[model samples]
Target chain A: MATRDELLACLAQFRDRCNADAQLRPMLADWERTILIRASDLPAEHLLIVRGGQVYLEPAAADGADLTVIAESGLLADLFAGRITPTEPYLNGSLRVLGTEEDIMRLDFISLMIWGE
Target chain B: MRYVVSVSLGSSKRDHEVTAAFLGEDFCIKRQGTDGDLARAEELIRELDGKVDAIGLGGIDVYLYAGGERYALRDGLRLLACAKLTPVVDGSGLKNTLERQAVRYLEEEEKLIGPGTKVLLVSAVDRFGMAEALAAAGCDLVCGDLMFAAGIPYPIRGLEELTRMAKKLLPEMTKMPFHMLYPTGKKQEEKAVTAAKFAQFFDEAAVIAGDFHFIRRYSPPRLDGKIILTNTVTAADVEELRAQGVKWLVTTTPELGGRSFGTNVLEAVMVTLLGKRWDEITAQDYTALLARLQLKPRIERLN
Candidate 1:
């Protein structure tokens, strides 16, 4: 289980990785969305707003985000770390992701660009 | 300094574009699809012939090889008739020539798919060049074309049968919509979560090979400790496959900006770079260019 600060750091790492990867930059060109991350064990402070080729951490989850992902802190860490896909946990109930197909695909693209197989 | 455009009867959603270097020269390559519209495809080839250096006919096969037998499709004939100034091919040239080399590169040279590997090739009809190459490499191949592509319950055994059947079916298939022949465009866009459907195949094989879209549309569950030997994977697809515990994702084509392409684009690339009329080119020329292009599968290892 990672600390709140560590989780915040993961979000930053994702943004930086996307910026550095030339292959990933093109996929992120049109990826402008508000993603809310809600961990069961942590408070609702981990909010990320993606726009203009960057992801920004917000103080609170936006009123109506383009995508909302809910999971426990440890599972959220696993999702961010590329240890597990959202589909696995989403099916098993460890994670719940709410978004249109496009929204989830956009986030998945970001996740792949950051840590790939 | 050359431009290569593909006139495809496929969908734009799956088509791709890239700018890359080959043999120390730079070129711009694009695949434009009519989404199964024949009139539009004809118009596209006519418009692009003079402007572009080469064109790849996509979605429909111009020719299929089965034990030295060439089965040409009527649809391909129509597309070929529309082109005059630029060299146009259906990527079969590369599929028949370089794909054999690529499979060898993966097994003996690159050692990506090693011997004793149990490979599940989705459909050899679409890529018989690769199918024949994999067979020649002595791989334990399981053909899924019948089950996966044709929606039949049986599995094909060898290259000869794959070629014979494709020769018989491809012409009839061309009469149907492009999406019906192979999943693409709106047909492929699904939100299904049925990993159980293809989990059996993923579990049995060391590598699931063939057209990525065909393999992906079936919704293969996470292939932890396994490999996906295919092409045209996006960044999002990698993320999903990684989460599924895929140890390696060996795309058959080199990618640009996280999007890999099919052989048609590369064949068009070959035409643009060679700067020769299509009829004048020969197998010898393709063999020489294969060494020159230096194009190989874009390998991604997760574990």
Candidate 2:
């Protein structure tokens, strides 16, 4: 069983991985919008994406935000770990897009870049 | 035609009798072993050899596997699997490990269905536990039901709340999870609303409730797509839904002890109607589906 802190650290690592990849440069432009991950029995929160030039952490939700990416923590871990396929959660309802479909699709591509299949 | 199988580790005739009464004549009640023993369990499963529609393993430790194989018990009956008989360990790492292992077994051994299948995982505790396990196991569209205290006591409200209260009352006390709880009269109504809400999120949704009244309250939205109902839904309810053009209908309550036991009949019904085997689905699939449906778990754990 992974602790909540451990799970949060894993998400941070995933964000770092996305920053190190150069091919993902194009999608980094729209990373400012908030990305909220809701999982387990916890509440939803903004995921902070720290960026320095092209190197960036994907934009997550702040105290208040326009976009939220809700999913079970385990699902997020699996998505980041490559145990399951990307876009699988959104399509299946495990990963829900509470924003507009377009915003959701944009984030979907970003997620693909971060997680890479 | 509903098929049922009761998987047990011991000759707990009471357990067999109870399961048989709930599942009816088409069901198989096989004895396995007690405690952490699987030798007899394996023998019983071998005898099943495709004769059963679904297998219900009595309360046994799912984590105590002798070799490479793990045991899979009925969905939502985690109390029996851990045999803790108290709520203190409900959210403990041990239970989580067992849930993950059970889900893994289901994924590796259970069969699959077409694109139309709907899977629901009902948890009396944190909805995320089952959701996370299922997702890790590769199930895509699993949904979950959270049990709540609908102002009732005993079997209706589920024992989770009392456990939480006990934890507060006895800060340093160790706790065991109990399965018995009070029933929520509004469970069916509340679940129906939940189903309708979930219909918007997933292509399919499975709403698990204790009684037929819940199914009756499940009036489909004006949306274009079709939704399936299961479990305690009777022949009359099926006729009603069919009249309304519900394309799929299946019953699974008999498999979960029976409709009388208030197990997740809707889940079984959805599995059968969608032609999905238990192993092919995971809690993540159901959680994701519910998330998409915007279907909140009925129960809320107090911090």
Candidate 3:
């Protein structure tokens, strides 16, 4: 399990990385959605609002989200912070992403852009 | 006659059945497409498991390789696991050995590719051997893995960059539904809107290579004087290529009837002829058999 502060810090790092990537913004130009991140091992939830090709973290409930990602808090932290690739946990059933396949693929591409490998 | 069936997730419109003999051994080879239905494909694999001498899983890859690293596709493995008695392959083995040999043959004998020849490989992770061969032969290579699969505009310029990109993305990408990565079923039949967008890559290259679908996906409307290096084209597909002004059509696999089959189906044929379990076979075995069969690239000048 990861503490709320720990997850927040990791997400903040992710936001900084995304902001630093000028190339990634154009890729997300038309993709605007609210993504809900819920921790499976804890009663914690966060919101990621994407508007105008920028991602913002909202420390709130999972309301009216277009996409939802459910995973352990530690896994979420690792994934958002670029410490681990999303493929292993996704395939092993530890990570569950519920949304349109196009959205999911876009999110994957975003991660790839932020982290080279 | 030995029976070999290719259970594909592609459109049934591409289904084919042929009777052929290899080195005095008669075989009945058939392809049954499931139109991108995973469960139906699994069921068909289960039904044909023990009944068929060998099975080939098409429109999906059990594994994708890049720079010595191999990633297994989740859905592909699921379909592969349905067969308990018969050996199943997705043609990665043939792509590695036979396609590499074909690239060499074209370069050495046909004088088609050589140093400074501009080549655009539609997707390389699925055909790493050909990518490597082209790179080694000094063709100015651009790999379209990113452009074709992810809708990304970035063109990977060299093998090093391609390998780097593959290492970063393939782990997760391969885990996703195989359809999202490659076109299947009706998706295969539709012309991609992005094809015209990426036509510059096609117009600049002297040779276009890789899976026929991927090449066709990002191909421009007119490919005047360009050589297409791929396999698994129907007669209609050939005409379409001719209409596009493709100068040369080179299929890595030999022509069976009027068309050449996908590597998966051809690999299943080889498995039946060798009478070997899938795991027991090696790349050398495939290469040796390719030599014995005297299978050469089906190269035709279309325009």
Candidate 4:
């Protein structure tokens, strides 16, 4: 199992690498929504958001978050590594969604990000 | 007996669909209301009564919707109506209900097999809770998992090797034949080749081919008085096997999510049907004894 800190580091690396792309830069710049990532071992207040030119990570709930993704940390790695799919995990009970389809579909970039190879 | 049971419940979001698979025929069994009403589901179940040996409930939501406030009573009656009622559980309140009822049924019903009977378990994936239940039931268990060589990838030739290894390893015990279970939407030919290899390893083997090609192409050189062939046997299959002087078929009910066999129900049903008296016989006698009694049809429902 990857630790919370390791996961955060991986996410940060992904953000840094992807942000360098000219096309990706515009998307990140305008990515102004709050996203709550609920993991089993982590505190519920661990929030990630992008506001203006800065990325924020703090122990506070982001108000009016656009999406909440619920899954175990290991599953997140598998999803990010292209070992499985969002639908597969959800059908197999490894992933659960409490939000609308739009909220879930917002993360469609995940497939491209992890499995572009 | 051919059963056409329908599982009906209240929740629309819940997965109440029934997955029925027999030899050469597998289909989704569901009750769609004309106006999406719950009564139609109930009527379907009533229509299927006394026709099928089992009516499998696919998920927890279906149970709640079907039983309503009186879900417990309805659930019990549902179990009694069919020879078997398999309720799928996936970390919900419904699982708790099924667990409670299953324990009671085991206590009241006769054990499926006699004490110390040896049984074999084979699967291509993880065998969760099955080995434990067999142990608890006092079965002398011999189990094996499929192994793939490095770089071989999924659906490898390991199933055949695994069967051979099992036969070699379990020389003293009677092998309960082999069954191949594949995921939905995957082709059965790959699995058939594996099953054929398994049958080749032993004289008397049963191959469960989910696809048509598998059912047709799988033919091992006749070991004559040694091997008996079955292609995805149903209730009718069991009757045919019994008529052919073959007895003691080892099978299990499908578990939730359609991955593995249901340990709780299989254990309870096995104990209730087989009894615990055969546990005392020697390995040789046990094998001979099993070859005499016709066993029940192994049923598995899709998630």
lDDT winner between 1 and 4, please give it. Answer: 1
Which is the leading candidate under DockQ?
3
Can you tell me the DockQ of model 1? 0.01
What lDDT score goes with residue B185 in model 4? Answer: 19
lDDT of 1 at B273: 73
lDDT of 4 by residue, B1-303 (tens): 123222423223322334544333444444222223334444554555555433433211211111112112233234334432332211122122232232222323524333464433333122223333444555444332321101011121223343433332222111111111111112222333334544433333322211112232333433222112112233443443345444333333233233222222222222222324212323343223223322232332211
lDDT value, residue B229 of candidate 4: 19
For model 3, report DockQ.
0.37
Q: How good is model 4 by TM-score?
A: 0.26
Q: Indicate the residue-level lDDT of B94 in model 4.
A: 19
- Candidate ranking under lDDT, highest first, comes to 3, 1, 2, 4
True contacts kept of 3: 0.36
TM-score of each prediction: 0.65, 0.27, 0.87, 0.26
For candidate 1, write residues B6-102 as lDDT tens digits.
Answer: 7766667666677878887787777786776778888888888777788888766677556666766556777888878878888888777766776
Q: Worst 10-residue stretch by lDDT in candidate 3 chain B?
A: B146-155
Model 2 per-residue lDDT tens digits across residues B1-303: 445444433223223323332223333333232333444444554555455454444332222111122222222234233322111111122223333443443345432222323444332232233345454544443332211211111121223432333232211111111111112222333334334543433334432321234234434542122333223333444555556554434332223342221122223322333344454655555444333333211111111
Pairs of colliding residues, candidate 1: A117-B301
Off by over 4 Å in 2: A1-12, A17-117, B1-78, B81-188, B191-229, B234-244, B252-303
Best by TM-score: 3
RMSD of each: 19.0, 18.6, 3.3, 17.8
**Two-chain DockQ for each candidate model:** 0.01, 0.01, 0.37, 0.03
In model 3, state the lDDT of residue B274.
Answer: 78
Q: What is the C-alpha lDDT of each candidate?
A: 0.70, 0.38, 0.87, 0.35
